[model samples]
Target chain A: MKKTLYPVLSVITILAFGFLVMYMLYGSGETPIFIIMAIFAIILGAAILALVWPRFSGTSTVTPGQSPFLVSRGVYFLMVIVLLVSFLLEGFNSSSPWSFLYPSENPFVPILSIAIIVGLYLVLYLRKSVREKYSFVELWTMKANDEREQHIIDDAARKTYGFMRMLVVIMGLGFFAFQLLGMSFPAFSVGYILFLFIFVAHAYFMFLLRKITD
Target chain B: MEKTANRLRELRKVRGQTQEEMAKDLGVTRQTVISIEKGEYIPSTTLALKIARLLKKPVEDIFWLE
Candidate 1:
């Protein structure tokens, strides 16, 4: 039952993602009805993928804490980052670089964009293969942290946190200095920069933990 | 030395056990058992004790500080 459904969902997911990307890059006027249909397709595909994906995939034979599964998961995360940045920039309408792509002012665009992302998350989070390979449940549930894993996580956290703090302080001071010099950076830019810093820090720590724990 | 040296591989071999076998008995993944054998990762106290108990060996016999 699931085998037939999985391929169809996978195809829809790919097509919907492609359509969304194109929509972001070339959409104009109102949020086109076709694009909305694409988003709905993504939602449906994602939900079905979640339900059917776990069974056919091979169970992971890799050892816990040593596999590169987390890094692989990072790929989907990268896609999410791209989609979100494009959406946020479009919504902010502050002469963002990508503003020319979809310059309209529809609020539902961002909302539907977010819905697509939620759908992606559901698919990834629900996959049996992803769950087994990444110890997905255990890590989130706080059960994967045996002593060595805990030590690795703690070390990575300390380093990444310190680095992020220092970067934020320096950037904050620099922004203040720019203000003093009559060169103003907008609060939105500052917030965006800070968010990027935190996101990068998290990715760095995840990589570090995987390396050190292994 | 405590983290680098262990008799896990040798002991398991003598017991006619595969890494997968030991991992199953110890409630861990096979890669963990391999890592322990390779001296790449040291188990927690609870896991170490479980391994020792499963293999019918003293904790000192399976793992020790150099």
Candidate 2:
């Protein structure tokens, strides 16, 4: 099966769970309707996840985030995005006021929008702006008449790993600074604090544990 | 130092295989075979067995302690 199949499956699984959840949460009085809504929601979420997940974590040889239970660094990004979006759409007017988009409120919508947009930009940069000549899996898995490219691939993977580590560190530092002085920064404090904790935790895994090294 | 794997390159050539072809067979990449050739990174046991199987040789015949 194509690698893309997994995330598609993930989205389906998520939807099925969400429907069962709505069923349990609301009781059987309107269970069927709620179940339909939940299935729709799952499909929408899955579509988004399918498009985005592969760009970030697919094409990677290493299995990230450890079984995808909860999440690992590679998968953590998707989780972060989902959480932020959920936070934003918690209670907001949709494109049409009659239509609500994801249940976000006034405050969270813009914040989450900006956050998601930034995350999008960052992913693009990693995929494009940061140019590496080789992919890591190529090093270990490719066959070569000449050995040079294999070494290059290994080196590239290592550097990419290092670069990601550096990114986590930088994000951590930025978040730490925000956490310290976020009181004056409006929601910046809370956002920064969240960012800090996540970055610190992920950085520990990325570097100290060499979690992405594989 | 003398190489440890005796006939990886020869066996591959005898099969009229390109390094890229072998890499593709492994579902990994072309550059990986080069690494194996240069002995920069040793192949995993699975990969070693695969290469041996592909070449119609036992793993023992392909690899030996130097």
Q: What is the C-alpha RMSD of each candidate to the true structure, in Å?
A: 15.3, 12.7
The CAPRI-style docking tier of model 1 reads: incorrect
Off by over 4 Å in 2: A1-70, A73-78, A86-188, A196-214, B1-7, B25-28
Instruction: Judge candidate 1 at residue B30 and give its lDDT.
Output: 74
Q: What is the lDDT of candidate 1?
A: 0.54
How do the residues A37-104 of candidate 1 rate in per-residue lDDT, one tens digit apiece? 45654664464344324422323233334422332233234444554565465636745544443324
Fnat: each model in turn: 0.23, 0.00
Q: Which stretches in model 1 have alpha-carbon errors above 4 Å?
A: A1-90, A94-132, A135-147, A186-188, A212-214, B1-4
B1-66: candidate 1 lDDT, tens digit per residue: 134478989888999999888887887767678778888887878888998899888999888888
DockQ for candidate 1, please give it. Answer: 0.23
Give the Å shift of residue A139 in candidate 1.
7.1
Q: Write the per-residue lDDT of candidate 2 for residues A1-214, one digit (tens) a residue.
A: 6466645544543444344334332432456655665675566556545543553345533332112211232334543564445344532444422122232335565456557656654443344212242243332233332233333333444344344334444544554465578532233323333333444433333232121122
